[model samples]
Target chain A: MDAAFSEALIALLPNLRRFALSLTRRPDQADDLVQITVERAIAGAGSYDPDQRFEPWLFRIMRNAFIDQTRRRKTAGTQVDIHEMPEALPTDPGPGLEARLMLDSVRVAMAELPEGQREILHLVCVEEMSYAETARVLEIPVGTVMSRLSRARLALSEKLGIE
Target chain B: MQIDDETLMALADGELDPARADELRRLVARDPALQARLHRFEETRRLLAGLRLAPEGEDPLAAMIRGAVTPEAPALPPPANLNRPPWVALAASLAVAVLGLGWWQWSGRAPDGFAPAELAALDGLPSGEVRRLESGEELAMIASFRDGDGALCREYETSGGDLVRVVLACRDDGAWQQRFAAVTKADGGEYRPASGEGSIDEALAAIGAQGPLSLEEEEAVLRK
Candidate 1:
């Protein structure tokens, strides 16, 4: 493998972990998902078109790997309880008490969102992927990305009491 | 203007074109309700952005991937060798700029930059023909085309030792000058030469290359 590909992949570890966490909702499962995604990406590196953005390609791989893992777990009857999963939010000491409380409410609100809406929201908002890029990663059309994102944002606002 | 939620969200997300966004901005400026609706999308994104995972130290998983891919063989050139002459460094930077990879090994000024066999292959072989030299290096001319300046250029692949390099050269002042080149280790299977046009297209765009010439067009151009 080329150093460029290796470096690029390494640089994206945090983003991959974040995306994986958003998908699997458990840190441990997210790590496992990231591992599988990286392995598949390296193995199938030949198929990656250089003209395309690397983030979408790698994110697509991670999403597909998550789907595979979910399927296998469903077959084995070992799915984790979504409600029991730990909060994926960070407890940054930098924020003041009031800001932290606001962040906590946002986290809880985000957790209550439907899986599809939450994933799209995290991909677009947290990861800062463009709508088109998010669509590619989620394997949906641009219209769906916009619509789903709009719903998620609206839902989030309702929960937060934002004007 | 009765802008829907999708368009409003798209505007807040910076996905809408400038003209539409400007129009929306004007409307929202005058309408408090419209501003409030737009604020919802913006506020949600802001809160979500605040939840981004803080950057951490080197992940062990990344270390594992790095170790697995890097073999004992020196697949990449040493840092010292990259201190090329200014013109070559400029060309190399252009290669890096286009490819986003520091794999271009464009040695300056042939007779030394190119092997005699490589030069012969480019001159004598037609596009889509492969020739193996006595030295055992396999050279394949993939395609030929004219740059936006109408300069004749050829894309070729050469594999020898453990590295495969794809190069684009344009004929200038009766001599073919290397414009772009990317080298990758042959064993990794990371780069497939036949599928390298995507990367080459960026280089072609950098040089403003027109589409590849048909074989007949290439032949007629070569005869001129």
Candidate 2:
């Protein structure tokens, strides 16, 4: 059963990384965040409720781990890394150069957005999670999820020059 | 009828009810403004989809997280307090949870086959111990007990911090032979494994116990 659960977590790596990237705004930091989240997950596994969906449980762990990492960095006063504010776009090849440019535009715009809004957008729009699921992941009210995501989408659209 | 941002966002994210969705579809068809608004959301979703961090192919990130660490984050730090490496700290912690779990096991009235002094020592043992492995895994022993057949068994747990698992492993030869395992229940902070206890009881019933092992017999069984 643990093996099955671990396999389930493996299946969620992409989604987890996507959320981590959205929160951290850099590939390396996102990877680090995922690693920390997994470490905390393993350490805290004894507390997991098997009856519930694994994704939200995991998202909660990742969110908390990200929070912990942020807190620690804040305490350490560590210098921010360059990759954190990455200007490089994601590697997915869009349909055309124009499409690629637009994707880059969205990526930059997404980076510019606050972490809270970006996280909601990734959960709702990119990962296709509903408002309730996104809310549960972020531990916010469903209405807050909707409002935040609406504002994020509007922001992304305006920044991308979408009509 | 006017649509709020929440409803509009829900409709755009495909979260609206079918009746409402169909009505919205009809509304959009008749209203180019609504259609364009929906299209904008869809187009943004599309553009974002193209920015997926993990591209098509085998998901290397899972394997990476399972195996090695990227340069950004060190795989794991050495356990605090002890100068020894992480695995050694884990071994120590396991001994600690085992004792706690050992206490939890003996605290039960059933024929667990552990002595009172041994059970009482659990209180002396520390709590909230975290055992880690060389492979970047963690262990949390929920409880452990011997079956009726006198097989020294342990009902411990394993976690990668993302998922917790409760396992029943009976001593066979020299190593723990796993008999049962399942995801740990995170019922708030304090968790009681109902199924895990059921498995331990089931193992005793299936194997047919000779009642609780005496002190000498338990020592002999555990030594193996």
Taken over the whole model, the C-alpha lDDT of each candidate is 0.73, 0.58
Candidate 2 off by > 4 Å? A46-51, A78-89, A93-95, B53-224
* Consecutive 10-residue window with the lowest summed lDDT within model 2 chain A: A80-89
lDDT of 2 by residue, B121-196 (tens): 2222112234554445555443334565555654444454434454455666544465654453332222222222
lDDT of 1 by residue, B1-224 (tens): 57899998999899989998998899999999998999999999999998885775687777656654534445443212111112222122222223333443332323226678887866767787789966676877877878888898888877676555678888887788888777644321222322243466688888888656767777777777
> Per-prediction TM-score, please?
0.59, 0.58
Clashing pairs in 1: none
lDDT for A18 in candidate 1 is: 81
Best by TM-score: 1
Give the per-residue lDDT of model 1 (tens digit) for A9-107.
889988898888778777778887887777667656668888998888999999888887787777676566445654544467778999888877887
Location of the lowest summed lDDT over 10 successive residues in candidate 2 chain B: B78-87
Interface RMSD of each: 9.4, 7.1
TM-score of 2: 0.58
- TM-scores of chain B, in order: 0.48, 0.32
Model 2: lDDT of residue A77: 57
